[model samples]
Target: MIEIKDLHKSYTSGSSKLHVLKGINFNVGQGELVAIMGSSGSGKSTLLNILGILDEADTGSYNLDGVPIKNLNETIASRYRNKFLGFVYQSFNLIGYKSALDNVALPLYYQGIKHSERNDQAMSYLEKVGLASHAHHLPSELSGGQKQRVAIARALASHPKVLLADEPTGALDTKTSYEVMELIQGINDEGKTILIVTHEPDIAAMCKRNVVLKDGLIIDDVMINQQRASSYV
Candidate 1:
């Protein structure tokens, strides 16, 4: 569902330019769960930003689900981003004062959905994420895993074509991380495409495909037998 070809990006600091992505090519199909692994300065974050439309490449092409993802104004970019992408970050990125349901409903609100309808849809997503009982809880009231589940629910509430997770389990303990991965695997099984940017090997093993980047280049890309997260949970 994603296409990238000869992607190159660079940042200028004073007289020197730091090349982040160099002649990179990658593609992801519908219903695939892929893990992107890289160390610091590996260009993984830059790639994710481009994929999420949070940043643009200096040169090359990116097409999301057949539509070109380049040279758009911020307004159009935001619209496409809301329409096609869902994000789950390491920080959870939930509004502190908002309840889980409201946080999930926030995107729908931006889509201009009616208040009643947005809340209904939000609750349904919450139920899907096994957080219905905690719907009224604020982020502060919930545990770390629960907060992440709410964030996932928020991401899915928009019915995004691809889910992009950055360090989804970075803050949680072993058991909680596995539990969250189990939920993610379940979502992938239901035919939603997902891309996870992570540094952990065990977490990468849970995905169907793994792509490794180093020095702004893809050094390894392979499909492997997927490990079910449920076994660990």
Candidate 2:
């Protein structure tokens, strides 16, 4: 459902240029769950930003569901992103004052959905992530795991075709991280395409395929055994 070819991204640093992505190429099929694993400066987040249309690449082509992102204008890109992509961040990006249900309903509100419909959809997504009981709670009232679950629900409430998660478990403890991973895995099992960027090997192992990046380049792409993959979810 997504294709990236000869992707390159660079930034001017003082008088020199720092390349962050170098001719990276990859294809993510519909309903496939994949992981992008890398170290501190591996450019995984940059790639995710580019994919989500939050940032533009310096060069190369990115096609999502047959539409070339490079060809889209800012307004068009924003619309496409809102309609097709869901993002989860390491920080859980929730509105601190909003109730969990309200936070999840925000995207739909922007999409012009009716209040009743938005609440219904948001509640359904929250339930899927096992956060239904916490719907009325504020982010401050919830645990780390509950916060992440609410974030996931917010992402899914958009009914996106692809879910791009960056360091999803970075801020949580092992138990909470595992719980979040299982929720994500369950989403993937229901046919949502998931691409996670993580530094944790155990997290990457949970994906069907793992791609390792180093110094802004893809170095390894491997598919794990089906049984091992099943264990990850």
Candidate 3:
């Protein structure tokens, strides 16, 4: 579902140019659950941004679901992002004033889906994430796990080809983390392509494949026996 080749990225401050991704090559197949593991300055976040089409690589190639991604104007990029990618972040990124349902419906709203249809679709996604009963609750009214669940529902509501999560379990306690992972696993089981960026070993182990990054390079990529998150949950 995704491909990258000879990816290179850099940023400049004053006269110093810091190369964040250097000659990177990577790929994620359809229905694959992959974890991107890296430490600070490893360029995993930069890689994720490129993969999400939020940023452009200085030099390289990225293809998402057979579409080339490069130098897209903001309007085209936004359209492609809505068509191809869904994101879940550590902070949840839900609007403070929007209820869980409204938050999930936001993406559909941007897609020009009518209110009743978007609400219905959002509720179904919330049900999938086990948050249907709390659909009307504000982000502030939910627990950390519940808020994350709402975020996941919001991401799924867009029906994107791939789900990209950065530090999805970073803010929660161990139990809550496992619960969230369990939910993620269930989604992957249904054939959703997922890429999770996590430093936690246990969380990485839950994914089918793990890609380790160091100093802007993929130092290791391996497929392991998937450890079921449900077992941990």
Candidate 4:
């Protein structure tokens, strides 16, 4: 559902140019869960930003669901991002003053969804993430895992075609991380394409496929065997 070709991105600092992505090429099919793994300063995050259309590449072609994204103006990019992409950040990025339900409903609010319908949809996503009981709780009151669950719920509330997650399990304990991964796996099973950037091997291993990035290039790609019987056991 997503295709990127010869992607290159660089930043200019004084007389030196720092290249973040160097001719990266990758394609993610619909319903596939994939991980992009790389070390610090390896450009995985840059690639994610470009893929999400938050940042444009210096040179490359990015096509999401057959729509070319490389040349989109800010207005067009924002619309595509909101309408087709869902994002989860390591920081959870939840507004401090908003309740869990409110935060989850924020995206739909921007989409001009009716208040009552959006609230119902938001609550359903929270329930899917096992956070139904905490719907009214504020971010300050929730634990790290709970907050991340809320973030995931918020990402899923829009029912976007692709989910882009950056270090989704970075701040949680092992058990909580597994729980979050399980939630992600559940989403992927339902045919939502998921692309995650993470440094954690275990988390990457949980995905159906992995792509390793280095110096802004793809160095390896592997398909994993899904442990279907043990997925829920």
Candidate 5:
């Protein structure tokens, strides 16, 4: 569902330029769960930004579900991002004051969905993530894993083509991390394409494929037997 070919990106800082992605090529198909792994300065995050249309590549091509992605204006980019991409960040990214239900419903609100319909959809997703009971809780009122589940529900409420998670379990304890990964695994089993950027090997092992980046280029890509997080959770 996603294809990126020979993507190159760089950032200018004074007289020197930092090359972040160089000659990178990657593809993800429908119903696939892929993990992107890299150490610091390995360019995985840069690749994520380009894939999300949060940043434009300096050269090369990105095709999202057969549509070319390059240098889209903010308006168009925002629309496409909303329509095609869902994001889960390590920080949770939920508004401190907004209740879980409202946060989950926020994306539909942007699309001008009616309030009642959006709330219904949001509640459905919260139930999907096993967070329906906490719908009225604010981010501060929930534990790290609960907050992450609410964040995941928010991402899913849009029903986007791909869910991009950056270090999704970074803030939780081992047990909680596995619990959250189990939730993610269940979602992928239902055919949602997922691309996760993470540094943890055990977490990456839970995915069906692993792609490693080093020095701004992909050093390895391999499909493996998926490990079920439920085994540990």
Candidate 6:
């Protein structure tokens, strides 16, 4: 449940503004699994940052699950971010000293959820991502795929409405990437809205819809027969 109209974002490049997203219009419906495909400098990362509430667009509108997203104070933005969005990144972003379970439970800690309740919830999410047994492991002990699964578990622990993954498979090998995509596909099948930002064609093909970006604009948008990631996994 995302909607954007004429969204523009730019950054200061010395004396000039480096426009990254120029008049971009985009939409993703509930339960839709969409891939944002782009080469370097395509502004996909910028758009993802805006969608995740990590950055603000320079102009135009963004509505998420019916609420306008713009100019939010840090408090409101943090609340909305916790309430509606869960993010997975290429780096996994796990704390070095935390166990997988602890990493997943960190978000609930911010919500002030009690230790016992949050731990139970985090365990359930880890189970969902097939990482329950590995909950005791640290990121250092896990393989790349295992680390990503832990990240996915952490993202899902909050029961977020939208799962935003940027280059989720970028750091993994091909087979591992497929496995992660398969896991994501299973999550999407259960009615979660998902948007993946990736430059990999195979990764994008696994999604139901693909939006190709070029030079800060969406140059192609198409719905394709979803190639089941399970097939590759």
lDDT of each: 0.97, 0.89, 0.96, 0.90, 0.95, 0.94
Candidate 3 C-alpha lDDT tens digits along 1-233: 89899999999999999999999999899999999999999999999999999999999999999999998999999999998999999999999999999999999999999999999999999999888999989999999999999999999999999999999999999999999999999999999999999999999999999999999999999998999888877
lDDT measured at residue 165 in model 5 versus the true structure, 0 to 100: 98
Point out the higher-scoring one by lDDT: 2 or 6: 6
Better of 4 and 5 by TM-score: 5
Count of backbone collisions within predicted model 3? 0
lDDT of 1 by residue, 1-233 (tens): 99999999999999999999998999999999999999999999999999999999999999999999999999999999999999999999999999999999999999999999999999999999999999999999999999999999999999999999999999999999999999999999999999999999999999999999999999999999999888988
Show the colliding residue pairs in model 2.
none
Tens digits of per-residue lDDT for model 4 on 90-183? 9999999999999999999989999999999999999999999999999999999899999999988887889999999998888778888888
The list of candidate 1 runs beyond 4 A from truth reads: none
Best by lDDT: 1
Candidate 4 clash total? Answer: 0
Query: Where is model 3 more than 4 Å wrong at Cα?
Result: none
> How many residue pairs clash (N, CA or C atoms closer than 3 angstroms) in each of the candidate models, in the order given?
0, 0, 0, 0, 0, 0
Give the Cα-based TM-score of candidate 1 against the true structure: 0.99
Task: Tell me each candidate's TM-score.
Answer: 0.99, 0.95, 0.99, 0.96, 0.99, 0.98
Per-residue accuracy of model 6 over 115-172 as CA lDDT, tens digit each: 9999999999999988899989999999999999999988988889999999999999
Q: Candidate 5 residues 53-131, lDDT tens each?
A: 9999999999999999986899999999999999999999999999999999999999999999999999999999888
Q: What lDDT, from 0 to 1, does candidate 6 have? A: 0.94
Cand. 6 TM to true fold: 0.98
Q: With candidate 5 superimposed using the best TM-score fit, by how many Å does residue 128's alpha carbon deviate from the native?
A: 0.8
RMSD of 3: 0.6
